[model samples]
Target: MNAFDSVVVEVADIEAAACFYSAVLGSDSPHVCLRASQDPTSGFRGFALSLVVSQPGNADAVIDAAVDAGGRVVKSASKSLWGYGGVVQAPDGTVVKVATSAKKDTVPVSRDVGELVLLLGVEDVKASKEFYAGRGLSVGKSYGSKYVEFAADPGHIKLALYKRRALAKDVGVSEEGTGSHRLVLSGAAGPFRDPDGFVWEASASAPLTATA
Candidate 1:
C-alpha cells in the first residue's frame, strides 16, 4: 500500500521547528530535514499537516500545546461536516490542522492507529489523482471534485488532496502563494510535483532528535 512514510517541512530555524513539533506532537514527530533557502522570499502557504486525535478534547489540547510552543492560530476549532478541526500556523508559517472524528451514524470514523495525514492543495483534483495513480497510489475514498483521500499502509501517514482555493478557505488563508513549499513527503510511489507546486521526494531519514 502506498503511504506518506514521513513529511519534511523546511524551516528557517531547524531546531526551533523541531522543538515546536516535538512539543505539540509528542516525541515521535515528523523527521526534520533542514533546507535553508537562500531566497528569503520563500514562505509556505499551500499545504497542511494534520494531527488526528482519538478524542475531541485531545484536539483542543493539541492546539493549545501548539500555541504554547510558538504557533499561531489560523482558524479556531469547530465542528465541520467531516469532523472537529482547527488550523494553526507554525512559527515559520507552515499550517497545521488538529482534528478528531466526530461520532456519527452516517459517517463514522474508522478505527485506525495512524494519527497523521499530510494534506496538499492542488490546482486540479482530477489531474493530481491521476498523477498519483500513475505512481501506484490509489484513492480509497473521495468527495466529488473537491477532495480525495488515498489508502495508505498501516502505521504510515495518509495522503489527501483538495482544491487549492477550497483548501485555503478551509485553512483560513488566501489562495495566493509563493516560492518553495517548505514541505516534502517521503515514500510516495515516486517523485512528482502536483499541479499546485508541492514537491514529493522518494527518500527516508531518521526522526529529528531533541539534540538535532
Candidate 2:
C-alpha cells in the first residue's frame, strides 16, 4: 500500500527539539524522526502533524504536555461538532494537533496517542490524491477537491491531504510560506518529492524511531 513508515522533522534546535518531542510524544510513537536544519521557512509551512487519542481527556493531556514542553497552543482544546481537539506549535514552528472523536473519557487521562496522521496541505487536493494513488496508496476517505485520506497500514503513520488555505485555518496558521517544508516522509514508495514539494525517503534509510 506504500504506507509511510515514519516522518522526519527538521528542527532548528536539535537538543531542545529532542527533549520537547520526547516529552510530548511519550513512549508510544508513530515513528517520528528529527533532523537538525535551519531551513528558511515562514508562516504555515503547509503541513500539520496530528496525534489522535482515545478520548477528550487524552487529547487534553497531550495538549498540556506539549504546552509544558515549550509549545504554544494555537487552538485551545474544546468540544466541537466533530469532537474535541486543539492545535499547538512547537518552539521550532512545527504545527501539531491533539484530537479525538470521542467526546467523553473512555479511560483515565493519559498520554496515550492512538494514531498519528501527517497532513499535507497542497494547492490541489485532487491532483495530490491522484499522484499518491498512482504510487500505490489506496484512498480511505475523500471529500471531493477538499480532502483525502489514504488507508493506513497497521501501526504505521496515516497520510492525508487537505487544501492549503483550509488546512491553515484548521491548524490556526497563515497559508503563505516559502523555502523548505522542513518535513520528510519515509516509506517504501519514495525517494521522491511529491507534486507539492514534500520529500519522501525510502524506509530503508530511516529507523522506526529516532531523534536528531
- Please name the candidate that would achieve the greatest TM-score relative to the true structure: 2
lDDT of each: 0.73, 0.86
Q: What is the TM-score of each candidate against the true structure?
A: 0.85, 0.94
Q: Could you tell me the lDDT of residue 178 within candidate 2?
A: 87
- Give Cα distance to truth, residue 186, candidate 1, Å: 0.8
Best by lDDT: 2
* Candidate 1 lDDT by residue in tens digits, 11-40: 777666776787676665454444544334
RMSD of 1: 4.2
**lDDT of candidate model 2 versus the reference:** 0.86
What would you estimate as the lDDT of candidate 1? 0.73
RMSD of each: 4.2, 1.7
Model 2 misplacement above 4 A: 27-30, 205-212
